[model samples]
Structure formats: C-alpha cells, structure tokens
Target: MIRLPSPAGRRQFGVAVAGVLAFLGQPVPLTAQGFCFHPGPIARCSWFSVTEAGVALSVPSDEDPNLTFQAGALANVGPRSAVGGVLVGAVFQNDVRLGVRARYRRWLTDRLTLDVAPGILLYNGTFTADSPGFTGELALGYADWLGMTAQLDVVPFEFGTET
Candidate 1:
C-alpha cells in the first residue's frame, strides 16, 4: 500500500507551496531577456542516506554525495521562451555522471523560470551501470532543485540536474 506524508510533512509542503505562490504573484524587471551564458559551478550535498538503495539508483557510498557541474547558455527565442545546451560531469561528483543536453526555459513570471532539458548520457565511470542511457532536468529557477541527483533521483534517472 502507498503511504502518504505525515501531518507535519503535509503542513510543511503546504506552506512551501503557499510561499512559492506568493513569489509568483510578485513581478520583477525583465531586462536580461537575451542570451544568458550561465556557466558555473553547482554543489550538491545530502543530509540523509538511503540505507536500502533500490536498483534504479547507484552511487559510491555515503561519501559520494550526488553532484554534477554545468556549462550552458540560453538565449530567449521570444518573450517567454528560451533555448540552450548543457555539458554535465565531474568536479562536483565523488563519482561521475557525464552527459550533454538541450535546455529550454519558460518565464513563468519575470522572476520565476521553468527549465527542461533532455540529453544523452555519454558515460558514468562509476557505480551506475552505463548503457543506452539518458539524462535531463526539470527545475524551477533551474537553481533550487527539489528533486536532484542524490536528493531528486526518484526516477533513479540518476538525473543530471543541469546538463
């Protein structure tokens, strides 16, 4: 049987949703709506460990926290749409998840953005089984990831968050 969140978990989720809604209601200047070359470092760490990791996901150990790096750029095709590409891999991983993907973004509000990228997994020279694999991301602001590599790999997509 499927279990739901505890009452406390539900309340926290509700509050978080409400906070996001409040942010969505506010507006920001859409000045930088062009080619945005954001190639930078992203660090990921997990506070908890899965004592019983399932088959879908694999990693070195508790020592190998989920992490990946991104080098990408997006140019707005219109007022609300954007297109780009990303390269993903090491520097952030104790292991590695390497891939490349095409990224797209849609401005929900001037301050809020949604990003989706789909790509191919080139290699993962570590615990995860390498194969005819895939990688991608679904994110808000493309920064604060709710489901990420270590924390968000619910699909055990071993999803590279940015690339």
Candidate 2:
C-alpha cells in the first residue's frame, strides 16, 4: 500500500513549491484558477491502477512464458491522452526482470486504449544476461468488465549487445 505524508508536511511542501514558482515568475498550479491544458473539452481527470495481470512476450530463454504485472499513477493531459509511469515486473521460471517506464496512453475508442512505453530493465537470468538493457512494451486493452489486456514485452539487447 502507498503511504502519504502527514498533512502538515504536505502543506509545508506545497508552500515551498509555490514560493519557488513565484520567485521564478512561473504560473502556479495551486493558485491558478480554472486551469486546463487547452480551451477544448476535458476528459477523465485522473486514474490510479488497481491491478492488471497479462501475459508477456519475452525473448526466448526459458521453458515457460512470462507473466507480468504493473501498477502506477496517471493523469490526463488531453481529451484522449494520459501520461504516467509504471513499475513493471515479470516472472518466469528461469527469468526475472524489473522495469520502470514512462507511459503514454491514448484512447482509440470509448472502450479501447493503447499504451506505448519505452524504458530500461534490470535483466537477471541465464535466458539473456545479468545486465541492464533496453526494454519496450506495447499493450492493448478493453477497459470494461474484467478489464482484460494483452501485452508484448521486448528486451532488445540479447540479439546484438553482449556482456
């Protein structure tokens, strides 16, 4: 579970941030009124992932497929676009990797959404190598009952880079 700072600490931090913005002459979000990225209509305000489970496509290295799980926070940047980050971890019999990636989510339809994320991973196992490498993911989801998704996870260092 996520733990939040105390109310007094949060208020102090907010005051410090607003002071800094004022010193720099930057428009303060805390004091700004009716702020939106654009004058157009807005979409959902924000989102926090509960939990999602899906299969992962990884570089062939083990006898079993990878299962991945992700959780994170997101905020809408546009009518159909949301930006955020995720902490992704994969489990395989012979492989384990953890990745942190910035995500860009776009709504293709009212029910369909696509996520594109590129980041780095800490690869650990005999399937690839015990090294840090580039990671990319593409996911498609139907965000309704069951909240199902399919995702492809790629580690693009095994083919060329070696350690």
Candidate 3:
C-alpha cells in the first residue's frame, strides 16, 4: 500500500521541489572541457536528478530507528563531474535535525560515482551556538534508475569534542 505524506511533510516536499526548480532555472554556462572520459550520449549541459524526495531508514550507532528525508538537484558540470546541494532532515528524539550540504560528484564510471559533501548540521528546535556543527559525508553510489549508495557522515568539529 502507498501511504500519503502528512500535511507538514507535503509542505516540505513542495518547498523542496520549488527550490530545486528555482536553482535549475538559473542561467549557467556549460562547457564540454571538463572531466569524464568517453562521454556518453548525454549532452554536456544536461541536468540530472541526483536525488529527488528520497527517504531513508537510519539507525544510529546508539540510537533508535529514524526516518530521513532528502532532496537534491545537480547539473552536469563536465562529462564526469557535477555539483549541487542536498537538503536533509530527520526526526529524532521528538525533534527535527536539519542540514544542507554542498555536494561535488565525480563519476568513476557510468554506473559508479563518488560524492563529497560538507555543510552545516543543526539539531534541536533552535539553532544555538552549540546546535550548529561542521559535518561532512563521503558517499559512493552505483547510480542508475534504481541506485544504491553507501555513505558515511561525521562531525568534524563540536564545541566540546576532542580530536
């Protein structure tokens, strides 16, 4: 059975879609002089949906199961490279954790790609000094119609953290 999103969820989805469209609508120059070997049939200026309203099930190292919602948009900057941003949110401990990341992707092969994202993570209801932290993610994915991604995220710096 297909379950529908709640009112709030729907609102978030709408805003995400609008944001992606607005980003894509901006004028940007496309050059074929970038990376990628053996350029495929796709055009150099083509835009790909890196992620669109994707939902993930996550279980932290010492936490309960959580649901994550993510949305992103990327344009092919080169034959084998793309750049974009992903917005993610999770409901944990009755609070919403939100983050926005700038992503850079390099396609090792037509089916495999590496993504690196660095951005800010905000937890709890308010964005206090301690609530915001530096976070980054490294992901490898077999990108296709139905793709699989393995990702790891880490908090590099925190107010009370030791290296």
Candidate 4:
C-alpha cells in the first residue's frame, strides 16, 4: 500500500507550491528572443522562432521519501513559458506517474531564470485521485543549459493497484 505523507509535510508542500505560483504570476516583461544569431545585410530576422525545444530529466522527491525519476519534453509556447508532459517512476518501487504541465519562466538577470510550472496528474500508479488533484514545480535555470527543480504533487483519491 502507498502511504501518504504526514500532515506537516502536506502543509509544507502546499505552501511551497503557492509561493512558487505567486512569484511567477507577478507582472514581468517578456524579453525572450526568437533567434540567437545576427542577421547580415541581406538577411531578414524571423519574428517568431522556436526558442527552446528539448528533453528534461529530473530526480524529484517529497516527504514520502521515495526517489522518483521524471523525464519530459519541453516546447516553447511564449517568450518565457513552456508546456510539456512528464512521466515519473520510482527508482526502488513499482509505481508510475504521468502528468502534463505548463511552465512560466521569469528572467532574474541575463543568465538566470526562475521557472514555475503547474499541472495535473493524470495517473498515479495504484493510487489514483478521483477529482484530479494538482501538481506544481519551481525551478532555477542557468545559462539556458542547466536547471534545478523542486516539485509537489497531490493525489487525493486512490483507486487500487494497476494490473
């Protein structure tokens, strides 16, 4: 049986998620660029270019103490936002999770960006939520190449084991 985390843990998770969302939701300027090159005398710049398109991998944990690996693809939807889907699996357990998320990125400076993602968990292994509980993530991106993220997921209802 999969046991949920303690009440304190849950509260902490909620607070963290709320904070991240609030921070990201603040009014910020859109400063992302379409191209990363300089146009020559005869070249014209495209107004809209796909800024980022890549796969991301992470090992995220919660108060439950289970280490899980999450892999997903991210595509740029706006200047500072991305949307993607992720598959999460426990490293030492048999549970699998799937989710879809939308991320908002805020540039802190020239090389640092604060990222916030909010989404829904479609599947949570044996224990599935009835009302479609939510998930949130906060990340720090550096130099457009490296990132670190913390995630919180809540699945309130369970629907037994999956065969």
Candidate 5:
C-alpha cells in the first residue's frame, strides 16, 4: 500500500516546490510566465536520463565501462529551441565525475522535439591519472510524453598538456 498526501498537504508541498523553482530562475507553471523548458509546451519537470560512451585517452589500471546517474533542469532558450544541463554521479566504481552540460532543443510540435548539446565536462576519479581532466560531448536526443527525454552522448576527453 502506498501512502498519499492529503489535498491540503499536497497544496502546501506544491507551493514549497514553486518557491524553490522560482529561486532557480525557472517559471512557476500555471501561474506566471518567466522561462520554461517543459516536456513539450505544457508540463514541467520531465523525468530523463542520459548515457555516455567514450574511451579514456590514458589507459587505466582496470579498463571498464563508464557510467553515471543523470538529473537536472531543462530550460527553453527560444521558440523551437531550449537549453538543458544535467549533473551525473557515479554509483559503482572507484571514480565519480560531475558534468555540466547544455543542449539545444527544437520542437517539431507540442508533443515532440529534437535536441543537440555540446558542452564542457570536468572529471574526477581515483585512478593514477590526473585529478581533473577537460572534456566535451555532443548529444542527440528526443523529447516526448510531457517533457521526458532520453539522450546519448559520444564524449571525448582532451587531456591537458603534461608539464
């Protein structure tokens, strides 16, 4: 059995979320107009995921697949266009990285859209390599079903010059 909030409780929770969203410079849905990067044209906070596959420039002690958990905000930059960024953390492995990314979303209709984003990334890991590495990625994604999106990126890292 699942416990659900009462109507009054739900209202208060919604109001609190609205205030936090406002501080993030995002629009409060069904209330005011500021900036929104919703699922389609109507819906806020779509659940999404991003996957990345790439080879490290420097070979490590143990070569394994790289993966992380992704979540963050997507904002509309213009008509038929929006920008979104995500933070991904590791769950299993000896390393974790925090990535800041941006994407361009183009809407074909109110329910469907396409997007591409290229952004810089910073990596931190527990390997013999450098502490932080500079990187960039490009992704193509599809947005549907009330702002939900799935994305894949081909990321490549450019190791800094050895001093």
Candidate 6:
C-alpha cells in the first residue's frame, strides 16, 4: 500500500525545491526563451585520511592519534573549477562537521593533479569550532584509489586515467 503526503507536507516540499534552485544559480523565471544549457565536464571524486603524530607544543601524546574521519564528493564545474561538500566526524569524541568548498584543480601531468579549495567549516560538539580557510592537495593517480577506507579490492575507473 502507498500513502500520500498531506497539504502541509506538499507545501514544505515546494519550499525545499525552491531553495535548491536558488543554490544552483538558476534564474527564477515565470516565462523564458531558448537557453543553452551545458553541464560541462564532471570532476572526479577522491577520498583521503588525516592521521599524524607529534607536535611541538606537546611533549608526548597518543602515537598517530585518530583525529577525524571525513567523507565527501567533488563536482567539476568547468575544466579547472570544482566544488565539493564534506562531513567530518571526530574519532575520539562526539564532534560533527559540515563544510563546502569552491576548488580549482590543475593538471600537472597526465597522471597527476593538484587542487586547492577554500571554504567554511561548521561544527557542533563540546567545543564548537568554525573555520573559514583554504586547503590544498596533490594527487598522484595510477588508475584510481586502492585500499581506500575499505578492503573491497575493486577498481574504480573514475578520476584517474582515461583508460
């Protein structure tokens, strides 16, 4: 059996749709003429982990402390422009984060790419922290990611080589 939403639920759905359209930079047009739409090339998705040890301020601490776990997706806006959204969760505590970034990637070589993303971070936990900053990364791709987060031993044909 299937159930339908009430009138209030329908109204809420319309509002959510409107918000999404606004974010995508589409004009709210009641009537329009012919418009050319091109989505262009799509950026590849990548995953990375941050785990390091030692600090100058601290004499000793947990070796290779697990600080954070993040997962996100990257979308290519143009040949060199990309954008992404990420969710971060603390490994040792109950801290959660949500962030979005505008990025630009340069193809250094046929198998290597460099990207820089600057954006804001929003978190909710014991001590809330918000940062508006930029982050950069260099990726060396042979084909795709291997041994990434899981042990699936699968080959991902996205975001690497054209083969």
> In order, what is each prediction's RMSD in angstroms?
16.5, 10.5, 8.5, 11.0, 12.3, 15.8
Model 6: per-residue Cα lDDT over 30-124, one tens digit each: 22221212211233322122221211111254434335443444344444443443333333333332333333444443334454544333322
By TM-score, highest first, what's the ranking? 3, 2, 1, 4, 5, 6
TM-score of 3: 0.58
Off by over 4 Å in 3: 1-45, 52-60, 126-131, 144-163
Q: Name the 10 consecutive residues with the lowest summed lDDT in model 3.
A: 33-42
Candidate 5's residue-wise lDDT over 67-127, tens digit each?
A: 5554555555445555555544443255565444554556666556665544333444332
- In candidate 4 the C-alpha lDDT for residue 22 amounts to 55
As for TM-score, the candidate ahead, 1 or 6, is 1
Model 4: runs farther than 4 Å from truth? Answer: 1-92, 158-163
lDDT of 4 by residue, 56-152 (tens): 3434433344455544433334444443334343422456565455555554655677767777555566665444456787878677666676667
Which stretch of 10 consecutive residues in model 4 shows the poorest summed lDDT?
39-48
TM-score of each candidate? 0.47, 0.58, 0.58, 0.47, 0.45, 0.37
Task: Give the C-alpha miss distance for residue 118 in model 6, angstroms.
Answer: 2.2
lDDT of 2 at 130: 34
**What is residue 48's positional error in candidate 1, in angstroms?**
35
Clashing pairs in 5: 39-147
- Model 2: lDDT of residue 91: 83
> Candidate 4's error at 29, in angstroms?
14
Error of 3 at 126 (Å): 6.5
- In order, the Cα lDDT scores of the candidates are 0.44, 0.52, 0.54, 0.49, 0.43, 0.32
Ranked by lDDT from best down, the candidates are: 3, 2, 4, 1, 5, 6
Clashing pairs in 6: none
Best by lDDT: 3
Candidate 3 RMSD computed on C-alpha atoms after optimal superposition onto the true structure: 8.5
